[model samples]
Target: MNAPAHDNGRLALMLNELRLPTIGRLWPEFAERSDKEGWQASRLLGALFEHELAERAKRRIERHRNESHLDPSKTLATLEFGLLPMVSKAHVMALASGESWLEKGATILMFGPPGTGKSHLGSAIGHALIDVGYRVLFTRTSELVQKLQAARKSLQLPSALAKLDRFDLIILDDLSYARKDQAETSVLFELIAERYERKSLLITANQPFSGWNDVFPDPGMTVAAIDRLVHHSTIFELNVESYRRRKASDKQSARQRQLPEKNQEGGTTIMS
Candidate 1:
């Protein structure tokens, strides 16, 4: 009778059959190193498994990051914390880790003016969460509401909401930009209701809750939306000088200083 195939060959075949390409490809080199170094069988196997697990984790994180649609430039590393004192660095870091209040399907409301870093901060948080394996999707509130309205018109709102559930966190930027139409607000309400107590939301709004009435014309709807969102939420009020506005002013001042002075009669005059 022909001798049975060797155990090493059988093991390689089985690993490939299971589709564990990483482990299968590396095992031959791992075994060679073990023999050359006189390593214990247990130690050699442990190293192999560790390498496989690490590679799998890296690929998983990469997949999540690509699907997240986050701003590659926005992250805590790039944040100008000194420019905004109202927001605590420690608190922002805690939330970015996605292991604190996010556990309870909580909401985060970032309130600030247009020139402030509201959208930047929101996208940064999403990037951080995705790095640690959280699924995040970021979009403008107006754009998202339009999509929901389209789904409703097509009678596929439920399917659309179900697809959105794939994200562990949703970052909705510029909430105040959503039009104050009844049809639009209704879909927005539906999204909030679906995610309530189920998934986390981070919203950046140029207006405060009191002014939210301008987005949802119905007073009852405004009250209901605010009540649900703020009940289990953390609000970040960035009451700092507008970063964009300050930069623009600085540029204007530099230009003015570079220009030659003109007398009231409109002739260029050299300064003494």
Candidate 2:
């Protein structure tokens, strides 16, 4: 038989918020059904409610963990078709082997021409590292160099690099995109030297090693930097067609023949 529905005044608000049906609907049904059930039906219902609450707590914890992960939102799914098989196949296996250089400390160099998906691949790897619970710092090569110079002026260079060391993986995207002076080049090389073997470095560049001398400005420093970078690194050369060109062509073809109307509702406000 079921126990009497007590005056649950203390939890009445909570029960109502949980959408638990009131006695008006449930009490009569329980009373009518209790005669047939040998066990206490109310106890069974309470047990079910407790079990559901526990399950919900577990789910909430899992959701929080997933959301807390530094998901860069870069995934293998968004990778362009041309670069997929090569990067995802044996390459992933090679890097993931032994102590996980990707997880531990190693370097990955992705060299290719502009619009060949270099940044996308580097970012995807960073996201993959984050999934493995490694802290990753990502920035464009140009921006990193600029920030380092700014730090030197503020006398915070050491502190800045110290913070960089905390990251398990560092991704420098678009290396050599903007023209860098000799001092900036030296600072960048020093960063690589300092981080050598201490943390994993992921570099994406539009130019190959052969063309890197243009970035370093000094031929001797260029050779030294390239030597240090390639010594213990996995290199991928992407020689694919420009995805940007394809996108541009599609956009051009979709242009309307007639002039589109422009809306200038407010002064100096332009809308197309």
lDDT leader: 1
Candidate 2, 1-272: lDDT as tens digits: 97565665645555567765443335445555665675486775765566556655556445433543323445555655454444555565345333467544578898777887777677666655554455677787787888887888898988888878877777788886735553466668778888877777889888888778767758888888888788778888877777567656656766642223222233353445
The lDDT of each candidate is: 0.85, 0.67
RMSD of each: 6.7, 10.4
Residue 80 deviation, candidate 2, in Å?
3.3
Residue pairs with backbone atoms closer than 3 Å in model 2 (clashes): none
How well does model 1 score by local distance difference test? 0.85
Local accuracy of candidate 1 as per-residue lDDT tens digits, 1-272: 97564688898889989877788989889998998999997999899889988898899888888887787887888877777778788988888899766678999999988978887888888888887878899988888888999999999999999999999999998898887864476788888889998888999998898889888858899899888899889998977789667757877998777665435347767667
For each candidate, what TM-score against the reference?
A: 0.83, 0.62
